[model samples]
Target: MDIQPTSGSAGQTGGFAAGGAPSSGGGLINSDFETFLMMLTAQMKHQDPLNPVDSTQFATQLATFSSVEQQVRTNELLTALGAQMGALSVSQLSGWVGMIARAEMPVHFDGQPVTISTRAADLADRAELVVRDESGTEIQRLPIDPGRQELDWAGVSDSGAPLPAGIYELSVDSYAVDELIASDGVFVHARIVEARNENGRPILVMESGQEVAAGDIVGLRQAQ
Candidate 1:
């Protein structure tokens, strides 16, 4: 199957870059060690037999090289381990495909009723569900029961005419008598259509054509 690259947040990419794993430290250390050995051989060949080279200095230099080599190998091992972890993350995220995820995002209307899950403030007495179009114009307003966590939105205008199928936004406002207590965006359950890697992190594409980070998902369940 062909895989397509997905765009991700620039902030996330920057954070990933800040890690700065030393992927090439091993090769650089090996090159430097070869040069060190050549220089030591040349110095030995030119030294006088009477004076010769100091054995202590030679021992110290060899010890330093060994320490540097060990550090480089450790870095290489860490880099390999990071790669393996990344692969494992992708494999685990792949299991989310075909599952249902609940997230706070825009909804896509396809000429059918969409199920929206929302939460109201604990002290609120009533809640209102407001639906808006892509242009941010209010299209429908309905009083919702705060006790019921789920509501269905039929694609229709206030005049009982069907609205055009497209992306829309849903928000819930809680009221205490005449005062507005809390207002928050609503969440909806959508099937995971695909999973893609963005900046070494998993991103889920929903059936609503929305792309959200896996971390942003608040709930997950089996697809119906």
Candidate 2:
């Protein structure tokens, strides 16, 4: 499988100081500082000789600028960190290509038997695998060994006729004698054909053309 690395923008924005001037990068910071000096010089020159500007007020203005510059630097650092993490995530997902991932999604039957993986509820003595169509109609029920973790469906009807290829839902019903114990069927395994990014998240594309989030994968193994 040919897996391409996903590219994404870091979405870094320029950090502005208190006066709405950009304070990021060496060049921009120098410009902001020069602007500050010019403003301070003008203020000092225009001050009345009799009632000069308050020294405390000048100190406060300088402190405000300093705070803004620090905030801008912090933002730049965080942006760089975020970009590095995103690159690392893409690199990790690339390794998932050609591996079989177990998840809890609808089965895609394509001429071959579909392999399902699940576990019976605790305290249950028997398990039955229930197959349902797209319209929620129960088509077949097969007795399954409660102790087993994997089951293979031949994609055939009860009369031995081949079923059409499509997506189907499955559920496992656990029973103790005639009493229903639990209903659960959230497990299936499929080979990962490709890896892609969607909405800034890594998505694993299965051989059946289904897309699942990389984080949703419960188990993975080498594809045979």
Candidate 3:
């Protein structure tokens, strides 16, 4: 891929100036560095015969310039590395399209339901799953256990009637007491139906029609 150098960048070195069109007369070093070099060189050349320039001070200035240059080079390398890594990550995540992934999200009590594989402390009292429709409206509430439980919503409403197939969310609530906090809630294991980018960030489109960022992926598996 051809990467056109961004505008107002080439001439600006270390936040120096805004770059316009390219010029051949000017050297690589900006006016500031050039002026510093000229002043230092002139001072050394015009030093008095008796009180000459200090060799140690000159060495220190040279060392400072060298260090600054190295730092600039290091920063450029890091920026390049970051851009390359971002591209690679986006490309690799695209392979997850059409696959099922377990992503961690705040989609609590959405339409999706939760499933527990094993029993845990206070499974009966704590197990609760809530489902929601696309508009974030609560649909139904169901009780669950810490053990293997599938809180599947059969695309039905609270009146036990079939609803249109669309995106939904699930949230898990495993509270101990009436006024207590809990963590065991239903999670989503949605199939990634599509892969796309949102605001330059990679995202996965779940079969439930929910879009999730690639960074939100907690687990991944092949489509089955």
Tens-place lDDT digits, model 1, residues 1-224: 22222233322221112123223464576676766665556555554555555555555666666676787788789878877877777788899999999999998999999998888788889988888999999988888886548878887887999889999999988889858988889898899988877767778999878999888999999976
Q: Where in model 2 is the C-alpha error above 4 Å?
A: 1-37, 48-50, 132-143, 158-160, 175-182
Between prediction 1 and prediction 3, the one with superior TM-score is 1
Location of the lowest summed lDDT over 10 successive residues in candidate 3 = 13-22
Q: Per-residue lDDT tens digits of candidate 2, residues 96-149? A: 999999999889998899888867788889988888987888999988887748
Best by TM-score: 2
lDDT of 2: 0.77
Tell me how candidate 3 scores on lDDT: 0.56
Query: What is the C-alpha local distance difference test score of each model?
Result: 0.76, 0.77, 0.56
Each candidate structure's TM-score, on Cα atoms with residue i matched to residue i, is: 0.68, 0.69, 0.63
RMSD of each: 13.8, 12.6, 10.7
Which runs in model 1 stand beyond 4 Å of their true positions?
Answer: 1-26, 37-76, 135-138
TM-score of 1: 0.68
